[model samples]
Target: MNKHIVIVGGGYVGMYTALRLQRKLGKELRNRSVRITVIDPNSYMTYQPFLPEAAAGNLSPRHVVAPLRRVLPKATILNGMVTKVDHANKKVTFVPGEGEPREIPYDLIVMAAGSISRTLPIPGLTDIGIGFKTVGEAIALRNRVLHQLDVAESTDDVEVRRRALTFVVVGAGFAGVEALAELEDMAKDSTRYYRNIKPSDVRWVLVEATNRVLPEVGPEMGKWTLEQLRERGIEVKLDTRLESATGGHVVLSDGTEFDAETLVWTAGVKPSPVVTEGDLPLDERGRIKTTTQLTVAGTKDAFAAGDLAGVPDVTNPGQYCAPNAQHAVRQAKVLGDNIVRTLHGQQLVEYRHKYVGSVAGLGLHQGVANVYGVKLRGLAAWFMHRTYHLSRVPTLNRKVRVVADWTLALFFKRETVSLGEMEHPRDEFRAAVASNRR
Candidate 1:
């Protein structure tokens, strides 16, 4: 029987794993003796760092994701869900093309199902809040923010205008900070075009449950970030929780009330629910338990890594590698090599990496970074943020395109048009017909 390697998710781990494996096992990949298959709902791996830029209309959304089929031509790419995994039986149940789920046997399996947004139970969160996860959400947010300005400017009602102009962002992590900063900056610029709206007329709030924002950076850098945001007129409410957000009327735990048409949720993420669907050993946080070599504990043919794996950071001793693109990219390489080593009967190397510090984008030419004990802020940090992620992004083609986007952005005005209605176009058509009938 031919040896088959089936990777679950086509995010960082799945794409890179198949890419490296095809390269390392060049002849083996085509010999029919070894085959690699990747299954994912989407065909592209999103460069999540650039999502804020895409949301701000600084970069096109299409440029931020690399197509899985084009990147890994040698590997069989399946656009479907890996619903069930029977590792003990060496087969996985999948539903392809809305058909009934069926089992596919494999000699080895790499479980790299990533994470989804971790939302709270706060009232009206699901109805009012927008998630900043995928490209569609990013674009929708951009549209909503810009369109809200239009709504506010055209409206005569003070209450409606106030509600439309207020934007609330939950969480202060990289996603929350970047999204808030970029969207705020865009909205600020966009206000110049609105007759009744000024930047001051808009309210931007960053609601963080913790004392410090951007805790991924140390306390000092985090403090610096908080101050910078406040200086720019963004309300940084630390140690505050959102009590409710019904009908776009947000009530804070600290006795604050606000009406906002826009609510962006970027709190954090937990492991994908797919992880729990399997019989794999999982950590307390629902991440798959794995050895330092990125292989599943006590399972020879089973392996896992990326955001879904509890990969221990040997340097940190007690801590697992944080679910960031930095670790995911590096871990994927090690995982691919380890898989090949295991197949070739060669020695498998343990995965041990240290922190390279953190970097974050804060609108146009603003950013923060704490890289290699060196702290950077403002334009320098922003440049570092772009330069580093550009290099870390999967392919050379993507790197070139992102760099080009940055270069071109210098000579042009940031686009701030909202396309929110694109998400549900039929609503407007239905409303128009109803008005005609009346």
Candidate 2:
């Protein structure tokens, strides 16, 4: 019987691991010695770093994601969720779209389900706030922002216009900052096309509970970022918490209240709840507890990595690896190599990499980066951000397409058109069919 390897989640870890296995275990796979399978709800792996650019219309949403079938042809791809993992019995329950759950047995399992946006129990938050995690969310946000502009321009009511124009983004990390900066820039640029709307009329607010903005970057860069946002007419409220957002009425802990039509929540992320469903050992933060080798602690023939795994950080003692793309990508490589070694009765190597630095794109031709104790800002940093992420985006096809996009962007005007109808595409068809039947 062939040894089966089942991988959960098609994000960074799942895609890279499957790719590595295909390349490294080609002989084993062809000889029926081993087989690999990947399961994910989406058929594509989204390069989350480019979500801000996608939302700002710098790159097409389709280009930022890699289709699993195209990228990992050697591995069996399942478009579904791993609802349950019976590791003790070497069986996994998967639920595909429009079908009942089914079970499959595996010799080994790789848990890399990734993380989801962390949310709170605040009233009306679920109804109003949108996250900036997936490509769908990015596209939706772009359309929503443009729709808000349409509402502001077409309405004559002063209060309604104010609410429509006010955009609130809760979080000061890279996602929050980049999404706010890019969308704000796009909105500012879009003002020229509207006779009733001006750049000054739009209110962009960044509400961070922490004292600093970009904590990943040093304090100096964080302060500079705060100043830059302030200069760009963005309201930066630090050391303030969101009290409630009931009925689109925002109340902050600082005795402030306001009604806003748009609210983006990019605060943070927690490990996917699927991790808890299994019998794997987990840390206090609900991440799979793993050793330096990326193997699930206290488990046999099981491994975990990426945002869901709490792999010990050797470079930073007493801490686990940060949930970032850089670490996740590097960890996947090591995990794949180690898995192969273990199968061949060879020794395993620990996963360790020193902290490089941080980078953030503020807006068009503006950014901040700190690498190896050297700080860079403005156009230089922006170029560096694009170059670094572009190189890490995965697949030669995607790389070429992204570069093509940037090259064409220099010559053509930025596209501000929103295709929100794509989300509910079947609605029109269903309505037409219903009318015909009537």
Q: Against the true structure, whose lDDT is highest?
A: 2
User: What's the TM-score of each model vs. the native?
Assistant: 0.96, 0.98
> What do the candidate models score in CA lDDT, each in turn?
0.89, 0.92
Estimate the overall C-alpha local distance difference test score of candidate 2.
Answer: 0.92
The TM-score of candidate 2 is 0.98
Question: 293-371 in candidate 1: lDDT tens per residue?
Answer: 9999878799999888999898888888999888888898999999999898899999978788999999989999999
lDDT by residue (tens digit), candidate 2, 283-376: 9888998999989999888999999999899998998899999999998899899889878888999999998999999988999999889899
Model 1 spans with C-alpha error above 4 angstroms: 426-438
Residue 17 in model 2: lDDT: 92
Clashes of 2: 0
| Residue 309 in model 2: lDDT | 92
Q: List the residue pairs that clash in candidate 2.
A: none
Backbone N/Cα/C clashes per model: 0, 0
